[model samples]
Target: MEKEFNQFIEKITLTTKQKDEAKTKYTGVCKKVHDYYYDCNYDGSTKFLFGSYKLKTNIRPITKDQDVDVLIKLPQETFEKFNNYQSNGQSALLEEVKSILKEKYTTTDKIKSWGKVILLQFEDSTHNIELLPAFEQDDNSFKIPNTENGGSWEVFNPRAQIDAFNESNKNSDGLTRKICKMVKKWRNFTTSVSIKSCSIQDWAIDFLASNKVDQLEIEEILQKYFEFIRSKCSSDNKSYVETVLKRIEKAINYIDDGEENEASQEFRKIFGNEFPLVEDSSKTNSFDNNIFSTPRPWLEN
Candidate 1:
């Protein structure tokens, strides 16, 4: 896998075409919001990219639900005004955002209210844009409406998260970003692992932020990531962690033996078909012809 890390990175990186499509869709989201708010006699606010896209650590999803998160910050005064007008203030605010998106994207996309965000899913595209309509607070935090729990507001600082990751990336010689992308790639392949995408990002950021990143390589950082989860995970997730950790160890051994083809195959066991396989002259005679063997335990969909 070490020999083919660059290939794996290229495979997982979003292409220019994909990025442009996402940008166009996101522009539509912003435009719809602006149009809605303009009709209401209020100025539409600025939107900030958050989550993996903001950090530039996103990998291509293996599944249909590829998510890109952005935050739309309206004025705090508007939030206060709206809250006073509704019995269920937060729910009303969230629904208002969802309603605008639903109406605007009716022909091309499907909009769903999920947690604090409105999800815009296009009919012919795998990319899912999550719009978190927020109120910009004086403290530089965002007040997001949660329709659940009786329409309460929650404060989130995505800027802080972005800053932390950027700072850590600088010190780690960019290993922090590489590790995050690699783990995301691993998670994309692990079907039975029920961890949320946000959880994965948070866990990776927190782990890498505090780690000693002096001389660690990619696989070593990955091993430590699994070990960190093994230490912190509940009994249910512990089993999955154990399985992944063993496979990682095997891949590392293959790397140590200078068997990168085998190493890539082992890494593929953990990260699925996205891990590329390259022919090696040393293994030309030892290669197996049977390609119909059962998939590795962790590689099953």
Candidate 2:
């Protein structure tokens, strides 16, 4: 079963075309976020970047353009001052971003402002840019309120996650980019149900939690991940994401560990054999069907 899982993981990795596509999107995300950072005065000077975008790929992976997450840092002082803050930092930064986006992306359609924090999404023109404003805590760390997984909310220690990610990356050149490709690769394979594939982190979290896989597996996966990138990705094109997916598919075929099987089954059951939040009629049973699946009047038609 472990071997099967390994095979699946290996198979799900990205391919040259997918890697190139992911890289193109990756570059766009980096540029737009960087521009937003500078535009918002959140550059190195203030409202600093403190997400996967900056760190080496393993710690903070980016799969798609939308996945290149950017969090606007609010120092302890600023975060405390905000009237109300949500665990998702970007929501907090919406309004401030609105004005800047309006000025920069003038031609963009109506950019709505609403939420625990505002959400700014710029699409229809070039690559998309989603800005999330987050407030830093007194200790320079923040946690999301509710997460399904026990570790539902991810912890960010501004300095630590970045430092830890970077320190390890030094051992591997272009580590940040490598993680991004590996993640994109893995995700592209796991959720073959449709184009709205689940993020690699989403799958990984489910797989790891359900199987009770240890950090060693994560690191082992990471090392193998490094080799995959070097062997497959190219200068003109990056097939990393697609190749990784093939590996993941291979892993999925042999994945029969009790916990993993449970998790994967649970994942398919809850996420409709794919990621949730889509309109695919065939794949819309978000709740677990086996666990007293919710009835849909529309489905009766």
Best by TM-score: 1
Runs of candidate 1 exceeding 4 Å displacement: 38-45, 284-301
State the lDDT of candidate 1 residue by residue for 211-284, as single tens digits.
Answer: 77557667777898889877776676778889989988887898788777777788888877888886774756
RMSD (Å) per prediction: 9.2, 18.5
Instruction: Provide the TM-score for each candidate, comma-separated.
Output: 0.85, 0.38
Q: At residue 87, what lDDT does model 1 achieve?
A: 64
Q: Write the per-residue lDDT of candidate 2 for residues 1-301, one digit (tens) a residue.
A: 3343333334443445544643454344334444754545322333344444344232212222333344544444443433344354334445555676566445554455544222334453322334445555667675322222321224555577566455544543333344444454444444542222223323333333234223444334543543444433444233444444444444344343323443344323321333222233323344345456666688796
* Number of the top lDDT candidate: 1
